[model samples]
Target chain A: MTASSALPYQRLHVELDARRYPIHVGPGLLDDPDMLVPYLAGQQVMIVTSETVAPLYLERLKHALSGDGRDVREIVLPDGEHTKTLASVERIWDALLAAGFNRRCTLVALGGGVIGDMAGFAAACYQRGVAFVQVPTTLLSQVDSSVGGKTGVNHPRGKNMLGAFWQPRAVVIDTRTLTTLPARELSAGLAEVIKYGLIQDVDFIAWLEARMSALRALDADALTDAILRSCAIKAEIVAADETEQGQRALLNLGHTFGHAIESHQGYGNWLHGEAVGAGMLMAAALSQRLGWLEPDEVLRVEALIAHAGLPVTAPASMSGDDFLSIMRLDKKNIDARLRLVLLSRLGDACIHDATPSDMLDALLTDFPRR
Target chain B: MTASSALPYQRLHVELDARRYPIHVGPGLLDDPDMLVPYLAGQQVMIVTSETVAPLYLERLKHALSGDGRDVREIVLPDGEHTKTLASVERIWDALLAAGFNRRCTLVALGGGVIGDMAGFAAACYQRGVAFVQVPTTLLSQVDSSVGGKTGVNHPRGKNMLGAFWQPRAVVIDTRTLTTLPARELSAGLAEVIKYGLIQDVDFIAWLEARMSALRALDADALTDAILRSCAIKAEIVAADETEQGQRALLNLGHTFGHAIESHQGYGNWLHGEAVGAGMLMAAALSQRLGWLEPDEVLRVEALIAHAGLPVTAPASMSGDDFLSIMRLDKKNIDARLRLVLLSRLGDACIHDATPSDMLDALLTDFPRR
Candidate 1:
């Protein structure tokens, strides 16, 4: 057995009753096979990855997990948002069964958010809950989806419309994998990092405003600082309300509008974080119209989002009715009441339905160029 | 809405930390819309039922729920053990999306175990959980699957091999529904009624022994008494261990062996409880071989199961290897060790693995005749 001292990592614990687990953040986690052994309960392991990620780091992750005579098997799915379907989840179940998996088997989600969501869900229903570990490679996943354990596949009507709140046993965030991440993909991830600042922490927003250039340049220290802070904020929010009943809705600051955009534009046309980044500006403009945030603050939020290479404008062809129609089908809606999380000001957001429909209609038509 | 005080019903509250809800047991519950209204979160309600159940009671249930400007939608799936597939669940998702159902929409499972399981799982994953009420129609589901929060669809590998633990908002059990249940189906239901007595309460066992004929005859009083006691025992077991980590597993007394038989014979060929009934005899026989139960006691257990019109012998075609092969694939297996729930005495059963393999193999070969 390898000594524990060999693994250099920083641990952040997500405390949600019995579903509590750890998020280990650091470089060289792939070298520490011991990090995985303690969380796994059996010899059987299935590594679920995307075609985009498999050729890059699949073998190394497999090598890391093979330390304790583990029976490591894998299934590589087609890449992108299109792959997050029930058909793909069924294939995972098929692969696990073909390999003789049982309730004791552990599923290792070894890619970005799509792998984590689909694989985590596959584990949730496979034998009614098996252990699974997340190794999120993308910066967006490292900051948001990997730690909170909201695992689900996208539905045709809306994004993440069907799923379970299945938590993982552990999340291993190996920041070193970001080295090979495409520049645009990294910028898309910065959108979520920017979200953490716009929603909760102002000091962190100040930090990002100063160092976003370093983040774009793939500076290790800047990226680690961004990932660590974003995950910590999310961990606290998830711990408070794991099921999104009340306080947890704050995490969806731009998500309601973001999900609507993704569904309207089709899943792959715009990245999740890019939609979210643009959606945040819409929310900021609405918050300003509600007299909660000043117009200048809305401009600040917009400029920062644009600086991170995120789209700040909704598709010109999408009428107000298009936004209203998709938002009506949002999974977050309670009895068709379209509730959205909007900033009262920078660094604080609240789930509100008080925005007048005509005002929202006007904003959708023009979206405040100033 | 009709006054709740006018509705005749008995309430048993299921207490689990935050998931506390009630099971309303009565004769005329289907006549009272008020009983359903309190549990429902929104104006939108989706009733999920089997084809057999939809023809029998769907309109009646819908009429009862349609009061006070509610939007009631229905999804009628094919009725049978075979319909509990992930594909069927996706279709339910499709229906919900097509009808614009969201987080506040309540799912009403209006049939037997298959409907409760599949619908409950659909609720659990529909926007990461919506409120769901159980209106279990079959006697078996009324006494067992409906009471526990164990929800999932079956995989090809095994029965109920894929699922989640999602508690219903409320369970509406109407003993009147059992009147329409087929005669053979009634006998199959009695197997679970017999099981509760065998595993936990000897007094209940003695009670069933005296009144097995009346229960088989579908005597309303006998059936109500049986359902109440069985539900009470199950509620306590589930309350103590909602996830089946410890004491909750004792409730799965005959399920491990029963699942193996059902898998080998194909699901619909042997009714679930019929297989469980035969499985309980195997468990009792093994318990006797372990010197836990006397031979006379084993004979008595067999007699009671047989008296309930349940199959007491294994199929001659299934060799010992067949049971071993399927049992090895069981969801209850802990790291390759096949664990069985066996009787310690008439009133109690415990999870045991100490019985030698040769003894079990010998018994399966010749299920000893008296």
Candidate 2:
């Protein structure tokens, strides 16, 4: 279905000093001919997309970006979470250099998290960084990866081992594209939507409990509100701390546990948001054991993830020790201490590191891959 | 020869507000273990050196950096300009990740410009950027690349196509290392030293002309003075314009022509300073055509380069069009305009874009690589 003209957009400002830019969320924004023009710093533009997103949105994006005497180029790669890497970045570098795009050139990332990360990273280091605009097509990217300006590729040793904090000129998030998302992908996106409510907004949690089904059904109003609130919450946290120094770490409530799930299963076996959804349950369970959360709240967290069609348990192959080992590899670890973001109470998340290992091991026995 | 204990050290401050650091030029600094400890942010210290430098000073540096229960790792790359590439950067990234060096880890560069650029670039992107220290072993890097925050590696299509502007935490330049430098390389470095005079310091030009022989002979006092003055001049320029917006372009007086020379010959074929020396003459000739320079000044520029044992002419294989085409690819070029840093008069330089193409072509036919 084509985007409705009556649909509204929400604009949130990141306000990162000189790097501040607007995150525009709306329906039919992708079809807007001038959506990307203002953020561009030069006439030389390149769209870095994936095999999947290119076929779906490449023509529309190209049409909007071209016909202005602009020198536009495209570098397409196979789609996968595994492809968010330096090798892919090299291919992008080759394309930009072949087209003679200098520091002034602007790279438009027109796909999900992988594309945004790879393209943004290429821009960050190409001639010491070029301006970029993010046109995140996937729901997960719109609410999470594309907004915060944390761009990097994975290394064999760990996820996002090489990266830079490069802010985009603008985030042109077109929620209309969510209509094309697969069911699993759409549900995975809601995990982060649920994350916002879990971390800071009890009222939003109540709102999601009522309206999440509508969002799952692709209801325009519900989906738009979920995305808008998520972006606003994330923007507020990032504006206070752009580099994930303190408050920003709250946004990664489940990501530490999530990263291990992805790493243990290999990068693409379980999608990031799926792992995060399950990982959030683990955090909820941990918080309950610490007496920061009630047993019912933990059950609600797991039930909500399961309702969204996401896994709510770690893989059976992963022991508590295995999870502990991988978690220690996290860049956030200070002097080998495993620092985690756990909910101190439902609707209020906090970073915690004092949980006993024996308690964590005993807790893992309750939830298996099944 | 052993370094004299009585040689007084001089310090030059870069003075960039938040990026400010000191350039310390002295003798026997390698023996001082405390030199780098304060700048290091963590116990994890990695030394990135070259095949040529490893045998000479790596052990001294490693010994100094260790024995304090510090975690030190070494990644030795092959020496030369050819080593400055993404592949080299990957080796570094691999080593850092393998060693589990986080953002707080320090990367110490212990070679010439090539090593300094590669290590600095690695440090810039490893975990979004780690602090680095520069221990330049060559004259060129000591006075030029190591002082500024410019860090990057070369691409096949151009020089330094991928890079970042990551400043080192501190620069430790041990003048004693230069005593081991090849005579040809030492002379090549003088080209940049003379450039400081031609661009901003007239008195420095007169001083160099009077004492060029003493420096060439490796007279400790003369060499010490030239290196100190050159670092101070460069530190001042970088402080005023950290990222080549306006005044910094003057620092590239002959680099536009020189980069084309390096690219055409294949990087590491002709020495960077040798090409810059010759390129400086080309700029002087161009300036004379603009009626901004006298014939005698052009002759002196060429003669000074010749006296320093650097090339005074471009290669015969490259026609004027070749220079123009390659130079247009320079990062400084905007909207296809070929911006060049040309001498307006002796002891002064400015960026010029109005030089007629026909004139440049006519001038190129006069100089050829014999």
Best by TM-score: 1
By summed lDDT, the worst window of 10 consecutive residues in model 2 chain A runs over: A1-10
Per-residue lDDT of B227-324 in model 2, one digit per residue for the tens?
88998988888888887788988989889989889888877788999889988888898899889998998888888888899998788788877887
Q: What TM-score would you give candidate 2 relative to the actual structure?
A: 0.95
Error of 1 at B47 (Å): 0.9
Off by over 4 Å in 2: A1-8, B1-8, B367-370
Q: Write the per-residue lDDT of candidate 1 for residues A1-370, one digit (tens) a residue.
A: 5554365678889998777888888877865786776788699999999999999999988888885578999999999998898889989999998898877899999999999999999998888889999999999889988987789988756678777888899988888999989877887898888888988998988899899899888787787778888999999998988887888888888887777788888888889888898888898988988889998888888889988998888876677788887787676766546688998778998889767899988877787322
Q: Which ten residues in a row have the lowest lDDT in candidate 1 chain B?
A: B1-10
Tell me, by DockQ, which candidate is best. Answer: 1
The candidates score, on chain A by TM-score, as follows: 0.96, 0.96
Pairs with backbone N, CA or C atoms under 3 Å apart (clashes), candidate 2: B315-B369, B316-B368, B316-B369
Clashes of each: 0, 3
Question: Where does candidate 1 stray beyond 4 Å?
Answer: A1-8, A368-370, B1-8, B368-370
